[model samples]
Target: MLTNRRSTMPMKHVRMPSWHAGSKTTTSALPTYTIDNTPKSLTPAILTSTTQSLPGYTTTRLIGAIHGTASLTHKVPKSFMKSLSGSFTGSWGEPKPLTQVLYQARDQAIERMTKDAIEKGANAVIGLQIRETEVMGCIVVSVSATACLVEKERRGVKRDSAQENPF
Candidate 1:
């Protein structure tokens, strides 16, 4: 029973549909998806039979790709934006020394992304991607990563550093 009126209607196409809108889906394991246009779904027809398992670490679950974004505007004073002193990295160009602004924006973006993952109980993030853009005198950065919990296989024992071996 769909309570939201918007959900009850036939959903408008948003990009290519990953799976049929009204079908019982089989992908009960995948938790996240990216906007990448990679080779289409891995159908059973092309299934590889020789899959080998790796060791040392086990992936307990996939929480999906969590994302965070930050935007900063270095409002350029009329003089700064129009003046020749800080404007232009080369001999000729338009507006302000942006190297520092870019750095700060990028760092803030990454910090937010990691904070998001931590808040969601992710031990680590993988497949990280950072994107940036400059628009209307503002710099915007966004970062995304696959957040998952990976547990390491325990060995025989872990000894404390201060413990002496009773040989």
Candidate 2:
């Protein structure tokens, strides 16, 4: 009487969501400057995409590397908050609690860098980098920049008098 017995079970398939997109990201490279040994008077040189001119000097070797670092620790003051939101409308009243403090630190770092560059007799600065670090309960902002004296090669030939002089 037990002719045939069968059990039927359904099969289920589950699919998970994906988080990858087809776009690719790329990073650009930084430029390297050649250091010069001889000290050359600082002059403002025009920067062109095709070529960069270094200071004009005989010895084109690295003389010295000057760097500046600064750190600032500050607590947000109530006075700063009052001024944060000018009488202007559509303004976010005052900066978030901690933002105002950070801004102060950034300004302090920049000022220090400027002073250091001037003291080192550097007319222009290159390879400027900045970083902000949080330690303990205080935030530390640090900035670093390279100051160097550059020289350019002098052309041998000088312009000669014109064949015909115009009155």
Candidate 3:
């Protein structure tokens, strides 16, 4: 003969890491619609990869987090566009030649961000980052940064963050 037995157990709540305590997963609410179907030329102005901060200066006040985004379709040559029938109509494989176009779009996004920073009276933007994605054969780029007004501090003067001077 055999008997069945059951044991009682209590469940414990697990906590998430501090980093992920506050996070939003939804892609921004920006309109996905494009104004002009035709792709435009792009130029990179002050979007250097090492633009985390202005050289010889440190951020004082953070104006706010600024963002700019741009979307561009593959500039298929006239010959290819004719074969595809006008603008791309659906999701499809991309041509390697389109890489340059994608870069142009990314640069355009950075340009817009730089303009926004300037308009806010910010001399430079810090922590700037660029992200890209492919959607329906269109390359979408987004630039994000903290607009800041930085002042060049005297190298000899030490920051006041220290409670006591070692010297």
Q: Rank the candidates by lDDT, best first.
A: 3, 1, 2
C-alpha root-mean-square deviation, each candidate: 20.9, 20.5, 18.8
Q: Model 3, 1-167: lDDT tens per residue?
A: 22334534444435445568354333221112236534445644542334666777766777888888999766544554453443344756434224445556676788889898888877767887888877898778998988887787689886675785544
lDDT for each candidate structure: 0.55, 0.45, 0.64
Query: Which 10 residues in a row give candidate 3 its minimum summed lDDT?
Result: 24-33
* Order by TM-score, highest first: 3, 1, 2
* Among all candidates shown, the one with the greatest TM-score: 3
Q: What value of lDDT does candidate 1 attain over all alpha carbons?
A: 0.55
Stretches of candidate 3 exceeding 4 Å from the true structure: 1-55, 79-96, 158-167
TM-score of each: 0.45, 0.39, 0.52
Candidate 1 per-residue lDDT, tens place, 63-86, comes to: 677777878766554543443354
Model 2, 52: alpha-carbon shift in Å?
A: 11
**How many steric overlaps are in each model, in order?**
0, 8, 0
Candidate 2: minimum summed lDDT over ten consecutive residues — where?
A: 24-33
RMSD, model 2, all Cα superposed?
A: 20.5
Q: Judge candidate 1 at residue 89 and give its lDDT.
A: 49
